[model samples]
Target: MEAVLPIEVEIPSMRVLAETELEEAEWAKQRCEQLNLIDEKRLTALCHGQCYQQRMARAFNARVRHREFKPGDLVLRKVLHITPDSRGKFAYKYDGPFVVKEVFSGGAIILSDMDGTENALPVNVDALKKYYP
Candidate 1:
């Protein structure tokens, strides 16, 4: 005796269910591919962003010159604090028509009072801004 579907109706319904399952599998695969494509796009955009950032940094560095102060050159020293209190934050951040007394090979500059008589502390070149007179 062979196993047979006494009701032909059940066989067609099972075939339909199988077809739907196959469709679902195809949908899942396509969705995965789409997700992968999206990830690839994001990766490309990230790489481009990094490249743009590097170019911006290079341009900024190129335009900005490294400070070189010679003796007798007047420069303004950046004041980290104007007062003992936090009120200094709102006040002038830079002070001085100070004169550069000496320049060190280590990027430190010895500043003198405007009268060129008194020597101040050695400060890094970064802290000194050129004074325009």
Candidate 2:
């Protein structure tokens, strides 16, 4: 009786098969090392991005001037474009020399007309500038 090999082709030498397996193992090891390096690079990039954002924020904050309004101070309120009385190009940018009626902690202030009538809504300090006169 003749013995049958699993494969139809002539059998490869044991030394050749051993060499092929060793080459595959080395390639896999190198690939894993490369993946680790890529992960490290990604983390470094993330850290650099966060530091850049913080620097930009600090520079922006440094240039910003804080506006404060006290009760009884006169300020000019900015006119809204959505107002019914706005003219196309010649409209006045500021509406009033309104008096600050009440000061709120978080930069909100209640405005009053010259006649002592208080506004129903609170306005942000940014929308008003100190009246020189």
Residue pairs clashing, model 2: none
What's the TM-score of every candidate structure? 0.51, 0.75
The Cα local distance difference test for each model comes to 0.77, 0.80
Candidate 2 — which residues are off by over 4 angstroms?
A: 1-22
- Using lDDT as the measure, the top candidate is 2
lDDT tens digits, residue span 7-50, model 1: 42232233443554657666556556766877898999999999
Taking the tens digit of each residue's C-alpha lDDT, what string does model 2 give over 7-126?
311332334445456576665575567668778989999999999999999999999998888889999999765667667678888989999999989889999998999999999888
After the best TM-score superposition of candidate 1, give how far the Cα of residue 12 lies from its true spot, in angstroms. 28
* Residue pairs with backbone overlap in model 1: none
Displacement of residue 49 (Cα, Å) in model 2 is 1.3
